[model samples]
Target: MRNFIFILTKEIRSYFYSPVAFVVITIFSVLIGYYFYNIFAAFSTISFQAQTDPMVASQYGVLNVTEFVIRPFFGVVSIVMLIMLPMLTMRSFAEEKKTGTIELLLTYPVKDLELVLGKFAGCMGIFAIMLSLSVPCLLLVAFFGDPEWGVIVTGYGGLFLMGGAFISLGLFMSSLTENQIIAAVLSFASLMVLYMVGSSSGFVGEKMGQFLEYVSILSHFETFARGVLDTSDITYYLLFAVFFLFLSMHSLESKRWRA
Candidate 1:
């Protein structure tokens, strides 16, 4: 436990000591703020139209702030995180290997699981910080409209789980190569496939389609975005993250043995 904390703290400090964290957070904040503005702007326009036209009001009925704004905002944030998270994870193991520090790191009196967990925790800490950027956006919504707090909580919960899954997969990808660029590319490609796989479900047979949909990260997230907290979705994300962390640990183990 002590060793895990040590490594975790070290990893977090490494991120701040370098420009990576600053750059990622700045880009993410800018992108998320832009999307939030657009989404809110659209919602305002729709609300104005509904107020002006009886037909528009009748067609749309009552515009739930949660549905019209918050839910879509969560969806867009997920997409933005999908694009931004790779930059955070690309150097997890790749930089260590590239700099020949993995040999020294492996020699430390720490268990493989501890090392993996520490790094995972460090990345997650940064992700949590990044996720907090949404709070202001949500507060803005709350100031003007009544959004469902329950839905907001569940949506953020889903995002945190999904982020864990993404970071774990990225760590595994980084462990496979010494080049950060290759690691980032691989992580993005893998995440994109996982995110979009559900779209192809419609073209397939029933069982295969069901399987594809289940495999898609987006499918599980949709339930959370709808304010539905299914244990099955939570379990899927936990397993997804654990499976990749397992792979990353073993990747490091294999390299340790080779060294």
Candidate 2:
């Protein structure tokens, strides 16, 4: 546990020591803020129209803040995360390998699982910070409109889990390459595939479609976006993260054997 904390802190510090953390955070904040402004603006316009015109209200039905604003905001945030998280994880193991520090890191009195967990935790810490950017947006919505707190809570929870899954896969990809760019590219490509895999489900047969939908990371998230906290979705994300983290540990183990 102590070693895990040490490694976790060290990884976090390393992120700050470089420009990567700052750059990613700045870009993330700008992107999320832009989306939030646009989404909220549209929602506000529609809401005003509905309130002023009974006809508009009747035509559009009830204007749900959760459905019109918060949900779509979270969805856009997820897409932004898909694009930006790779930059965070690209250097995790890749930089170590590139600088020949993997040997020194391995010699430390830490188990492979601990090392992996510590790194995962560190990345998650940064991810949590990134996700916090949404809080003010949510608060703004709450102040101006009645939004479903349950959906907001589950939406962030789902994002955190999805981010863990992305980071774990990015860690595995980083372990496979010494070049950070390659690691980032690999992570992006893999995540894109997982995100879009469900789209192909419609073209396939029923069984295959079911399988594809189940495999898609986005599909599981949709339930959370809708405020449906299904155990199956939670389990899928947990298993997704664990599977990749296990692979990352295995990758390190292989490197240890080779060393």
Candidate 3:
């Protein structure tokens, strides 16, 4: 436990000391804030039209702020995470290897799983920081409209899970190479496939289609976004993260043997 904490603290400090985390955080905040503003502006326009026209009013009925703003906000954040997490995690082990510090790290008394968990936790902490910067957007929506807080909370939960899964995959990818670019690119490609494959399920046969959708990370995330906390979705995210973490540990362990 002490060793894990030591490793975790080391990883966290490394992230904060580096410029990559700050750059990614800035870009994410700007992009998400812009997206939220666009959504709010469109919603305001629709709301104005609804006031003047009976048809438009009927179509809109009562504006569900939760549906209009919060859901889309969460969705866009998830998409932003798809891009940002790879950058955040691309250096988990890649940098260590690139600097020839992996040998020094392995010389420590820490176990491979402990090191993996510590790195995963550190990446997760950075992810949480990046995600928190969007709180103002949510607060802005809530200030003007009555959104369902419960749904918003659940949506964030889903986003966090999705981010963790992405980080885990990125860590595994990082472990595979000393080159950060290759690790980032590989992580992005793997995440893209995991995210988009569910859409293709429609073109396949019924059974295969169901299986494909079930395997998709987006499929599970969508359910959580919709405020349905099914055990299956939670299980999928947990297992996905665990599987990759295990793979990362195995990767480091293999390297130890080679060394």
Whole-model Cα lDDT of every candidate shown, in order: 0.93, 0.92, 0.90
Q: What is the C-alpha lDDT profile of model 1 across 1-259, one tens digit per residue?
A: 9989999999999999998998998899899899899989888898999989999899988888899989988998899889999999999999999999988998888899999999999999999999997799999999999999999999999999999999999999999999999999999999999988999999899999999999998789999999999999999999999999999999888865755
Ranking by lDDT: 1, 2, 3
Ranking by TM-score: 1, 2, 3
- Count of clashing pairs, candidate 3: 0
Misplaced by over 4 Å in model 2 are none
Clash pairs detected, candidate 1: none
Each prediction's TM-score versus the true structure: 0.97, 0.97, 0.97
Model 1 stretches astray by more than 4 angstroms:
none
Per-residue error (Å), model 1, residue 228: 0.6
